[model samples]
Target: METPVRSARRESAPLRSTLVAIGLTIFGLLGAAIATLPAVLVDPMLAKGVAAASIEGQTLYMILNFVGMALAGAIYLAATGRGWSYVDFRLPSTTGWIYVLVGMGASIAFLFVVNIVVQLLSLPAAESEVVAIVGQDQTMILIMIGIVVFFNAPAEEFLFRNVVQKRLYEAFTRMQSVLLASTIFALVHFPMYVALADSIAATLTSLAIMFGGAIIFGTLYVKTRNLVVPIAAHAALNAFQFGVLYLAIEYNVEGVGTSPSAIVGILPSLPP
Candidate 1:
């Protein structure tokens, strides 16, 4: 009887794994669709004559993305029978404020360096639309940065690093799980830009950068087993980006472009 029961349990493990994978995949797709629904639905409606359609679309997109990711995370936790307690909030022993400061410094320095390199190499910036948006309306730009740097970045860290990566790490090898989650993270941003040759090239390049960053962030989470470090780091990086944009717009920096060099103050002719 014992042997039979053990055999039955062993047989069920694979089935359970399959079900979990299916659940996660479905949840992810559903989440993505729901998150983008505002852009899909509102953009057209606004085209017809909605007041502040652009702002409405942007606001809705941010809201839906947050809500969709949260819902998906909840579903994932439920399906896996993992209690909320499993979501670790432990910070590193080094101290929270120290981590925040270090993260901020490191992220800003890295951005500064990368911006210099990109500018020297004449590489395109990740999102040109962001520049145009900032140029048109500074208030909107600030709102966008608030959403992305603080809210969206933290939410993403929670969902991807904490929830998805944590679950997958339990079920699979650490490296495999990290790679998988990072791939998913990069892929999620696929349709944010146009699909033309230049756009596609830029998108792919940005994904590669994001994937590399995700790996580092994911590894940090695994090592610390804490969400706070990665969250801080992610937010820091985003805030740095926003600051760079603000400076660029304020200075009417032209020809300085999105290249790393332009951002890092390497190009003498570029605006400070």
Candidate 2:
């Protein structure tokens, strides 16, 4: 009787683990969505000029979004009994730095491929929700560069990589976990691009690019076992991208598609 009972528990373990993983994944996704609500709510005021569409307003918006996500992630951790111990935030060693550099380079290289593929497919460029705000107030670009590194990058990686991807590892293979997490990352951004994209095809392509970029970030986190690697890499990429947009706008460069809308789809993890 004891042997039969033990075998029955063993048979149910995998199923139980899988269900738990699925439940947690849904919770993480919902948390991310809810986290964006405050920022989304402010958009109406910005448009009406009740809050000026300036750098200050945009910065507040970003801060709200970042803070919301961070709080949600903290709650998720606490609920799971993992808390902060589950995440690896120690400073990267020399080898970890090498991986950081590799991640940045690989992400950039990946962008180049994405740009070419977009052109080859003749798909129209996809714009993000942020691009609309930038179009209204150019000063928003200034704020973007300031916060993207310190806020946007860390917020996304901490939630998606550290919380979501790490949680998935318990029930899935390394590759499967990465892919699933990346897919969720991409899906969460879909609403931002849907109306802004030139066509459904363009929107889908943009999400695909986002998914791929997330995969790169996820892989870096998995390989290094350090969240900082992905966070740093994500920060550097956003900084480089927004920097280029600022330069192009300042120099009045044209016909090169350097605007926020043109390049936003090339990378993932931009502000929501």
> In model 2, which residue pairs have backbone atoms overlapping below 3 Å?
none
Q: State in Å the error of residue 151, model 2.
A: 1.2
Instruction: Point to the candidate with the largest TM-score.
Output: 2
Q: What lDDT tens digits, residue by residue, belong to model 1 across residues 153-229?
A: 66677777777777676556777777878787766545543331165665666566556667767776766777888
Model 1, residue 4: C-alpha shift (Å): 17
Candidate 1 wrongly placed segments (more than 4 Å): 1-26, 35-52, 90-93, 120-135, 193-200, 255-272
lDDT of 2 by residue, 1-272 (tens): 57988899877765665555455545554554466556556565544531344455556666655656656777878987998898789999999999999999998888778777766766665665555556534466666776777777787788788887887777677788898888878776676677567778768887887888899999999999999999999888877776666677777777333332344532132233
- Candidate 2 weakest ten by summed lDDT: 260-269
What is the Cα-based lDDT of residue 140 in candidate 1?
Answer: 59
Cα error, candidate 1, residue 8 (Å): 15
Candidate 1 has an lDDT of 0.59
